[model samples]
Target: MDLTTYAILLAGALAGGFVSGLSGFGTAVMALGIWLYILPPAIAVPLVLICSVSSQISTLPSMWKVLDFKLAGPFVAGGLVGMPIGALLVARADPQNFKLSVGVMLLVFPTALYFIRKPMAFRFGGRPADAAIGFAGGILGGLAGLSGPLPTLWASIRGWTKDQRRGVFQIFNGSVLGAALILQIASGFVKWDVFWLAMLALPGTLIGARLGMRTYHALNDRNFYDVVLALLFLSGIGLVWSSIAPR
Candidate 1:
């Protein structure tokens, strides 16, 4: 790998880990949006998973008390059920189309949520809705190393408190993404090339996570959401345009 590749890897890992630290989810979306422009989906997907897992390890423990395992259980189960199907799809997908789809995924969700003046907290969905969202998150997670957006969006719409949202998606993502990584291994996507790249990214991930956690404390709730959505929106546009541009 070239120095550029190494630099991009560290950059993505740092930014993604920072977001994950602040919001308790989003490691993959942030990272994959950057990586897909340079790396193939097969390599990028599992690499994002590794970075996601590391960010989780770095951030989860300090906030563990706020997490409610029971609250996250259904979502995790649903994600487990949906992961295999997503994993199956990637091997057959056109790489460009896969990137396009991920770009669209990144683009659409943030746009929709940006307009909300306050947490919507729709009354209808409840636990069943949560599970369904988790199932979808699993598919995305497996397919594009993105397991957080749907669940995170849903939680935000539900008007969950910061801790509540963090607790659920953080645990949900960790469980689902962990499973996705194992699936990648079994499917032969976890090679030494990706492994070494992940190793190179470890310091960046940890440092970013630490910095993000500190920033999370300093920023008020609204500021945090604004920054998160803004980054996603811009990255989404970049990924989409890249995927669709003529070679």
Candidate 2:
């Protein structure tokens, strides 16, 4: 990669890592956007996988105490089953259709958040609901790397505490994303030329996670939720625009 490309990758990694550290997601969206400008979407996806795994592993330790392991299993199981299918679809999908779909999702997600009432406590509707949400997350993750929002929506409906929600979601993402990365690697989506880029971004990921934990402690529950919603909306729009105007 040229110096300009290296700069873009580094900047994207730092920004994405910081956001994810604070919110438990968005690293892939951020990195993918920058990389898409310099690489094919197929290559961008695996590169994103590498970056996400690095970021999540760094963040997982501090948040480990807050993770809801019981709820994570079903979600992981469903994601493992569904992600490959989504990947297959992405491999064959028209780029224009992908942009349109992302645009629609961007417009819909924030509005959906506004209507949902937060529950008083954590409510797992049983294994069925868990499995269903997991499956939904996996499919979306595979197709667009946008799976975090679905589970976040479910968690919001159940009224999980901010730490609990973030921790659980990270665990869920780590499991599903780890598997997806393996598939992506096998398909040769990850390029050797970018391996160093992924490694170089690791420090940013670590810094971001630490900052995020601090931010999580500083914000009240309501403010934290609001911030997450806003990030989701903005990132969705950014992804849609990137796919459409990819420069």
Best-fitting candidate, scored by TM-score: 1
Scored against the true structure, residue 209 in model 2 reaches a CA lDDT of: 64
Instruction: Give the alpha carbon lDDT tens digit for every residue of 1-247 in model 1.
Output: 7888778888888988888888777777677767776778888888889888888888877888898888898899899999888888888878677667767876788888888776576757778888999999899888877788778767767776667777887899899999999998997878988888788887888898888888876776677666667766766776677678776
Candidate 2's residue-wise lDDT over 1-247, tens digit each? 6789777777777767777777777776566656667767666666677777777888877787888888678878888888888777777877556755765675587668756646445566776787789898888778656567777767666677787778777888888788888877787766786576667666766676678667877888788787787776776676677767845
**Cα TM-score per model:** 0.92, 0.87
The positional error of residue 62 in candidate 2, measured at the CA in angstroms, is 0.6
- Estimate the overall C-alpha local distance difference test score of candidate 2: 0.73
Cα deviation at 58, candidate 1, in Å, is 1.1
TM-score of 1: 0.92
Query: Which pairs clash inside model 1?
Result: none
Local distance difference test scores for all models: 0.81, 0.73
Give candidate 1's error at residue 18 in angstroms.
1.1
